[model samples]
Target: MIDYGSEIAITGDDPMMDFRADPDLIEFIEKLGRARNHYLSLTRGDFTLLYENEGMAVYTRSYKNETAFIALNNTSEKQEILIPTDKLGSKKQLIGLVNNDLIKEQNGNYPLSINGEESEIYIVRDNHGLKMLNVIVIIAIPIVFLILYFYIWKRGKNNG
Candidate 1:
């Protein structure tokens, strides 16, 4: 966790790391969390307002076409924050938590939101093998029935 009132440097290839704490950053984080509905359990205690000269680093992650918010306090004090996880667009990774918690390289809980507003989102990963199995089963049923139908029809015709 970053101190509530300190300068934090985010070095990465992420385009959102603008290194500015203006109202826009705060609004962007809030809006992203709301739109994505990633955190449905977020509450008022989750966020704390930064006074002038106080700022924090808001980290975001994208995975499996979902977004996650990780609010880090760079200030000198621990602040309650209400970070919006929905506005992250198609990213996945929870804020304030490491990536090893939720899914592989995923962190934090679901239904996280800003200021107690539920971000109606739930995260889940799909196994391709299961999907393929279901498809094969569904297709095989009809194919087998067709083959049996032809075999019986030919046998009856020859016997007659």
Candidate 2:
């Protein structure tokens, strides 16, 4: 959490003006917003605390055909953790939603490294679902076009 002094009021008209003056605070707020949105919007409301040790904690949430894993490090040093794929169910890939990084399952486990006082969120999804969705979209687009084309052609013929 970005700590703003009690003297500084973050609310009112132009609330972000003070926040914008500090570049580090701005970046921290942006990252926090991204992480919050990724967890709240994409994942199911329920979450499980997968692991917690010392100054680090790991949480996981599942939504639809995907699962989200979030790791937070509270210490001043970087931390690494190994998570088994079986704990995340039947997932084929772990894609970082916040940082746009991809981690493939290796030897039945995923190794993650998080910076000090930083949080990372990853989405676990099956490649087959993505491929099938793409195929459905590709076929649906042409069918939609054909339907529109026929409707327009019939309308023009009747008008003529």
For each candidate, give its TM-score against the true structure: 0.24, 0.58
Global lDDT of each candidate: 0.43, 0.73
Question: Best candidate, lDDT-wise?
Answer: 2
lDDT of 2 at 65: 53
Candidate 1 — what's its lDDT?
0.43
Candidate 1: stretches off by over 4 Å: 1-130
For model 1, give the 10-residue run with minimal summed lDDT.
113-122
Error of 2 at 155 (Å): 39
Compare the candidates by TM-score and give the number of the best one: 2
